[model samples]
Target: WLKPFWLKGTSSSQRPGNLYSRPLPPAAMKTLHQEESIKVPKGIKVTIKAKHVEVTGKHGTLKRDFRHLPIELYLANSGHEVRAKMYFAKSKQLSMLRSVCS
Candidate 1:
């Protein structure tokens, strides 16, 4: 009936609203951008001359393709509060690659 269809559509729209109810804190994004300006860690080197940022560390150098989205990288020795953000379509594969490259 019309009631069921209306309920379905309402539920669908509400789902995303609920998921995004709490957005990323502005302070966190600001900190990330500020951190990006600093030099890479002593053991880690980052080159952002090209479209993608190239990171070289103990493991090796890895190039992350950032043709469409912005990328942010955060490196820390410990703690969950320490992290970075980048734009890469938010894919698990990209996260894995960045972590390894860092």
Candidate 2:
């Protein structure tokens, strides 16, 4: 008669050999910390202060506070563009901020 495998106190899900016993390459690790930027509209005026960002346009003015998350807002391109930069952190949150700004 044939014997069952479960009676041996081992299962098929167990790995017999090393699965992840090596370190990633330098190039691969560098990609983990990436930088991203967002541009401001041409007509709109974006002012980044210590705590929040004030956007003014032909329609009206809007203010957005950023005291909750660990993000930095600043201007680039010789005061022609506003960029939101991120470094070595959660990328998912950055995408959410980008989508909302756009």
Question: What's the distance in Å from true for residue 78, model 1?
Answer: 24
- Model 2 regions more than 4 Å off: 1-32
lDDT of 1 by residue, 1-102 (tens): 455554565654355447664575664222222222243556776655434657778998888765553555454443222244444333454554355334
Model number with the top TM-score: 2
**1-102, model 2: which lDDT tens digit per residue?**
444664466544442443444554654222234444667667888888875888899999999887675556677886577666556555566675565446
- What TM-score goes with each of the models? 0.31, 0.56
Each model's RMSD to truth, in Å?
Answer: 11.7, 6.9
Candidate 1 vs. true structure, TM-score: 0.31
* Model 2 worst lDDT run, 10 consecutive residues: 27-36
